[model samples]
Target: MAVRVLSIDAAGIDLAGVALSRLEASLRKQAGDPDACVADFFDLAAGSGAGGVPSALLFTRGHDGRPLLSIAKALRQLA
Candidate 1:
């Protein structure tokens, strides 16, 4: 079995429409209050649970003959 996870943070981008506002809100929330940001996006090939290593992942796509990419990650909490 395998599990895939994603964590988003201050890095990446700000784009048009809902994406921009959504990302902005997320950044603000993560900033305003927290010891660590647990909020993230994930896609699991197996079961879901709170066990995994935090790291970064990059996604790429093509738009109107142009290529676009973005960075995302699962940030580790440090005390």
Candidate 2:
């Protein structure tokens, strides 16, 4: 089995959206999923300082233990 992971910097919640935007685009292109989520691709998420905001958002799980927030929704929350 393989595990994929992603790391976000401590760029603050405002700019975190920027990184998530770029991540959304890349995930969309690579995964071909209309609703791409960080939890789909990353088994583990880490952050530094204020990056914890997005790290928390990205880690939110549904009943099935999958990520609940779409990149758009996460973006909205960040906004």
Output the number of the TM-score-best candidate.
2
Model 1, 1-79: lDDT tens digits are 5554543333332222134335535754767842212222234212112222222212222464221222222211210
Candidate 2 lDDT over 1-79, as tens digits, reads 9877777788667677777878878987898987778778888888888787777788889898878887678778777
After the best TM-score superposition of candidate 1, give how far the Cα of residue 22 lies from its true spot, in angstroms: 0.2
TM-scores of all predicted structures: 0.22, 0.79
Per-residue lDDT, model 1, residue 58, is: 23
Kindly provide the TM-score of model 2 when superposed on the true structure, using C-alpha atoms.
Answer: 0.79
Residue pairs clashing, model 1: none
Per-residue lDDT value at 49 in model 1:
28
